[model samples]
Target: MTDRTPGFATLAVHAGAQPDPTTGARATPIYQTTSFVFNDADHAASLFGLQAFGNIYTRITNPTTSVLEERVAALEGGTAALATASGHAAQLVVMQQLLMPGDEFIAARKLYGGSINQFTHAFKSFGWNVVWADPDDIGSFQRAVTPKTKAIFIESIANPAGSITDIEAIAEVARNAGVPLIVDNTLATPYLIRPIDHGADIVVHSLTKFLGGHGNSLGGIIVDAGTFDWSKDGKYPMLSEPRPEYHGLKLQETFGNFSFAIACRVLGLRDLGPALSPFNAFLLMTGIETLPLRMQKHCENAKAIAEFLSTHKAVSAVNYSGLASSKYNALARKYAPKGAGAVFTFSLKGGYQAGVDLVSNLKLFSHLANVGDTRSLVIHPASTTHSQLDDAQKTAAGAAPDMVRVSIGIEDKEDLIADLDEALGG
Candidate 1:
């Protein structure tokens, strides 16, 4: 049967999936087996020896997970993708595949609190250093680049604060340095922004967010654009050089454009073992079908809330890219032209106490840590998410003591505004 090249919506519903040959099932069935039966000893040898691609174990790959991977790659306009157990796991997998001991990467200072901890503390043990650069200043990225710099990392739309990065500018710096630009597209997703289209070599996402909209599954994905030439300068020995473990096969030579994804799965996932569950993959696939719809509504609701917050007497400042006054508005227009996304922050006039009271008073918005959910959610970052960071670090990360992060949902704008009105003592 000839595969139809459909539009985005059509591809979302049918990509990397077809009716099961055995049962004629239209829905993707979870291949709940740990291992697949091989045809013969030679076939098994070829699979294990990297001569052929087939599922050897559930920990490395699975059929259900493969659908999710393919769908995400198609959505992000990447050559291939690998699904991981969590967003953090995806980051670890990418770093493990690319970075060696004493190598470094440049990252935007404004990032998720958990990500900051992961880069600063956890990755340090592995001898991977992160050079923090201000995303607002594109020149900082170029200045931060060193000989040991392997990649440039930034969020398309930063978490909590919702600052937008100038992806093309940063990618230019990475290109000049001969390093791949890695973008965490978790907030913007592919519906609003495809980093690969903006010159990002690798794009990562937390599927637990908008991609898995219902908050039922925890998953992540790393998508390779397949544009970067790993062998050009021999910066990445793992991909450019021969692998002794895989029978002297070089990834760049064998997989061609998709060498990065192959390395991430074969080496990173093979060693790290952070594969997404088949059940989670199925849930994530279901969620992706409605991604365009959900994302549109999310941006709409978020814009309304941000506007309201900006005008309110109690609000000291609003940090949404949709706002004209936002520092990121220009970049948001260039990169995320569809929308600036749902996650943003607003600071109250009363500082920390007011932030605490707003959360305590809200009736509709749930006070939770997670973002990109179907229901509206809020959090006082200084008291909760960034509590571990000291005053200086918190301010540097845009997590002020008075700031409250809101993840707007597909709810009635009037109702959401009214809920915040009462909470802010309107």
Candidate 2:
């Protein structure tokens, strides 16, 4: 075969997949068994000692989930990947290996509401502290980093507002601080912006969103770019120091480029126990086969709806990056030129009551909590998703009390526009 590199569309359907040798099945078969048999006594011992690459149990590894991990890694341009039960699980697994008790990480204030809550409250229980920085001001990240900082985290296309973070600039800060830059690329996906290409050391995703596309599955993944020097400052003992579980084997020394993925699997997932089910893995893989197509439609429909809202009398402001007048337009053009993505927020003229009324009045849009579904969905973030945050925290996250967020789908643009127009008193 020729050594021609496959395009994104080609990789979406074919990466890490092969026909079954025995059954000759074209689709990936779900290996439903919980435990895999070893070759013999020696083989079992080797697998247990981390000397072999075979699976022993479903909790640690499985064939179906392995395919999902490999496919996501290939798409995100990373050395290796690990899948988890959900986006929250993915975040937990990642920080577990990087932070010890009382260590800190810098995070952009413009993040998903759930993530803000997780980092602020849930992570604090483990003695991990999150220092907030503004994405609009690149210097904020630099100022937030201290001696205790181990990583910097941001989103490619932020939720609720669809603002684009300056990935390259923040990556620079992480480099000088001797810390890894972790980017959550769930909003843009690899189809739009590859975080690794912009100097991200690690890329993460909530596969349940754009990757799944149908909103039918719950999954998340972490891609190790193999760019960070985990052993350099001796900050990350989980990878640099000898591991007692593996008989004094140092992960970075042994696995080299992909050691982070290995540490997460054998150390984090093993103890945290947030395993992605093989059945969900099968569904997520199938969903990824058409990501390119679904994302295109999602972007096209979102831009059109944003334009409609920008000119409407009932709307005070629209926060879509695709709009030329939006504050985030230039950053969006630099990072996601194809389109600004499907989720964004618009403020209503009448205030918080109007935002709630608009979602109730809309016919085509489903009033729900989720995004990146085949059908369009809408929600008032201040009342639903971002309700837990205080007044200042909600505003910082782009989820203002008088704002309405929408996730456009693969529907006809005219139909979506019509729904918005009627809802806004056409």
Candidate 1 per-residue lDDT over residues 1-426, each given as its tens digit: 997677788778888899988999999999888888999999999989888878889888898999999999999989999999999999999999779999999999888878989999999999999999998899999999999999999999987688888889999999999999999999999989999998999999999999999878999999999999999988899999989988789999999999999999999998889989999999999999999899999999999999998999999999999999997898889888889999998989998899999999999999998998999999998998778988887787778888899999999989999999999999
- Candidate 1, residue 408: how far the Cα is off, in Å: 0.7
TM-scores of the models, in the order given: 0.97, 0.97
Q: Which stretches of candidate 2 lie over 4 Å from their true place?
A: 386-397
Q: Write the per-residue lDDT of candidate 2 for residues 155-224, one digit (tens) a residue.
A: 9998768899999999999999999999999999899999999999989889999998898999999999
Off by over 4 Å in 1: 1-5, 388-393
